[model samples]
Target chain A: MNEPILQVNDLHYYYNDNQAALNGISVSIYPGERIAVIGSNGAGKSTFFLNINGVLSPEHGEIFYHGTKITKKSLPELRKNIGIVFQDADNQIIASSVKAEISFGPMNLKLPREEVSRRVNMAMEYMNITEYGDRPPHYLSGGEKKRVAIADIIAMEPDVIIFDEPTAALDPLNAVMLEEVLEKLSAEQKTLLISTHDVDFAYRWAERVLVFCDGQIIADGTPLSVFQNDEVVKKASLTRPVMLDVYEELVRNGLLADAGVYPRDMREFRELIGK
Target chain B: MSHEHTARSHTGRHHHHKGGHRHDTGGSSIDFYACHSRIRHWNPGFRVGFSIILLLFCILANHPAVSCVIILTAAWITVGMGGLSFRRYFSVLTIPITFILLGSAAVAVDFSRQPIGDFHLYLFWGYLYLTYESLLNTLFLILKVFGAVSAMFIMTLSTPSHELFSVLRKARCPSLIVELMHMIYRYIFILMEVQRNMRISAESRLGFGDFKTSCYSFGQIASNLFIIALKKANAYYDAMEARCYDGTFAFLEEEHQANPKHLIAAGIYLTALMSFWLAIR
Candidate 1:
């Protein structure tokens, strides 16, 4: 409805030495939409993100940013608009220190030093990493590194930020911290795309879900509807979120005879059970 | 426990080089010490300069008495002025001490073709002996090496590697060498962690249940690490490209000007070290 901030049409990509990583997948993303790209390993979710972000150009199809088809000339604009927060913070962080690391993205935009400094300060403050500004980012904890990685992109002020498995290998506390940052980012009205296997996190956090299986997008809809599609979940080799499963079971057993709609999380489930 | 310090990873690549200054034991990193050092804010160029002058002074002076003063004063500055913990300081010296002792032993013991000197202790009919001259030379060499190491200890104990790298970058070291040092310093910690994790993963799978199995697992892990390194290098390049990396890495450096007080301290240290050297010579 908001002119599809980003769109991909029959997008196809392949590894140089391997088969197609993304095949015949298409989707449109809108502003303020929290999208969770869910699938098994090698499900083309990462390839899809890279394609839309212009890191990997599609061979068979095309990606559009703000209604303009992405190409070699439009790539820089597309990349600046659609930032990808890589899964491994160590890989994403190019600068040695946190301050320099955050400044990198903004400086690449070739903004004036004062504006770059402004953005750097704002990003560090936003990510709550001001204390570590002088510290080396490689020395930051997994969660701290993740924050700095996100901060690296946020400093650029991208409209659409994509995270590739933001919580993988992070400890429980760090994972929760990541969720809070995601919540804050979402609240700020920036479009967020995250590719992860954590169905529970997707169920609770994402409004929209896109399921990829074997390089093809099998389902795309609200998390409740898409995850509730047992066939899609089965094909994707993903278990349906427990909350959705329980809600469906209740409706099937006629125990939720008075139920109005499916619940997305524990709090919503409790409210539904109470009703 | 960073002693209420933030739970920093300290496993970063720079930490490997910073910890190199003080630890060959895989012990706790000395970066905490370096970051909190009294001279932490001192210009790295100044610290390096002071340490170099002190080290050369010791080596060129070559007097046991001057070496003693250099060693004692460096230890004092590192511990007192630099705030390096006694525990870490002692641990860091172990490697240097080992090498110096081995070298000194060679100097102390001799196999002569002629009759032994008057000060020599006869062994195997004077063919093998320890002479006073050799012993003196050994002691002097020991002191010289120890004093030189202690000078380095002070510098490494005070300045973190990244800052030192910056100083080197500013001094117009070949960019490629500096970058190589920076990258190698980082990947060492990352690779070491990867190696450690793979070992743990292997153990978890009982891949190392027996000596035969352990050897097999070691072989597998080494090969797997190589593959992982290749994959990681590829991923890192893509990430860098995603961030619009040009050829050079630009940083938002906080300026650190040289301190005159620090300069005065350097002057005083030179005066003290050389005064002892002059008095001894």
Candidate 2:
């Protein structure tokens, strides 16, 4: 579409024992696109994110950012534009206080003091954690720590933000808050790639979906297209999103017209049902 | 969400979690107190400086009066100004006091085949003797240690580790040490939580049904924790790398205004302690 912000070509990664974590993986991630990556455990989702974020080097093939090859010399520059929100907020938080943790990414960029402070304040305010600026991370609840972790990445103002199961340990209220944050980020036109097992969330939130299976991209397309592929669904052992199942059942019963498009969320489902 | 440390009851949070470890068994309580300490808002640099100076005075002066005054002053500052309960202060000190008692025993009590000191007791193997001079020296050493440690406690109890790290940064402490401290401080609680959960799970499974089983379970837990720590270390580095880390460290420091009254009070207290030491000497 718009000169893919990130392009991975036949990427391969191996662990210490020579086991392939990623094998022949290739994808082009467009700027400002909301992409959800779904896979079973040990499916190389985290490794893929690490590779794209330039934390892990691919043993084969190459990755490019804005058409430039990602080399050892370009990693620092690439990292400045692509941030990863790790699954464990505790491990991701490197600073003692919430403000310090948020400022860490910006400070690593070697920005001016004023700009760093300004970004820290803005990120805190955006995450609604401005009051926790002086509080240490150990005392914050799991949800609050998650917010601070997101703020840590947001402060860097990265173009592509990768979240590794951002909602894993989060309670229901926190999940809602996280969704709102994703919506805000999407509105800001930031490219967001989230790896999660929550098929319903992926179905509802993502404009495009990537199903990672055994370190390879088994399916990649709009959520509807990818989810409708029965072979891919069965191969990946993915459960159909509740909304998708209900929508298809209604169409089968002739209670609703086969509108030729699936609803992404509750609002769209309601609109489709004309109720 | 209140997220207010002061509003949260401390009694319910710490005791159940800590395992039987000698290294600050009161770790969480200390953290809670430091985070909520009323005087924490004071400039950490000033607090650190004051504590160091007070500690030096107590050790170098070596006068019983000076040590006593320091112990009193530290207790007063910790309990009175910092809003820590008197019972909590003593409870934290209990471990150190017990350690001191055990340590000074060798000096305070001596055994000889023949009775030597004015105070001697007959034992089947030998004679247990206590010399007044040695007993007095041991007493003075105990008091000096308590005074010095109390001075340190005043600083640590009032300032959180992050604030202390910020002060260290200002003091030009090596970035590597400070950065390591920052990471270690952040992970200690996480690791502790993980270990605590594992222990509870093991207990539920009767992994520690007997002494032998307890030893086996402890070994298993230790090995698992080691593996987890290694994995966590790699993940932490990856997370840091994603943030554009290039071996450079920068931490945001909250600016704290120094209260001149606190400085003046410290000066007056030090001056008063010096005079008391001189008079006693």
Best by TM-score: 2
Q: If you assessed candidate 2 against the hidden native complex, which CAPRI class would it receive?
A: medium
- TM-score chain B for all models: 0.85, 0.89
Model 1, C-alpha of B128: deviation from truth (Å):
4.0
In candidate 2, the residue pairs with backbone N, CA or C atoms under 3 Å apart (3 or more residues apart, or in different chains) clash, namely none
Candidate 2: tens digits of C-alpha lDDT, residues B221-265: 999999999999988888888898878778767778899998998
Each model's lDDT: 0.80, 0.88
Against the hidden true structure, what lDDT does model 1 obtain?
A: 0.80
* Per-residue lDDT of model 1, residues A1-275, tens digit only: 56988888998888864788987988888889999999999888888887887777788897888888887987889878778899878787766668877888887787888899999999989888899887755456677888899899999999999999998977898788888889999999999999998999999899999999989989999888887688997899998888877877888889887455778788888877776
For candidate 2, chain B by itself scores a TM value of: 0.89
List A-chain TM-scores for all predictions: 0.94, 0.98
Best by DockQ: 2
Residue-level lDDT of model 1, residues B15-101, one tens digit each, is: 454553332234335655566578677788988888889899889998998888888889998887776666668767886899899
List the candidates' TM-scores in order.
0.87, 0.92
Residue B232 miss distance in model 2 (angstroms)? 1.6
iRMSD in angstroms, per model: 4.1, 3.5
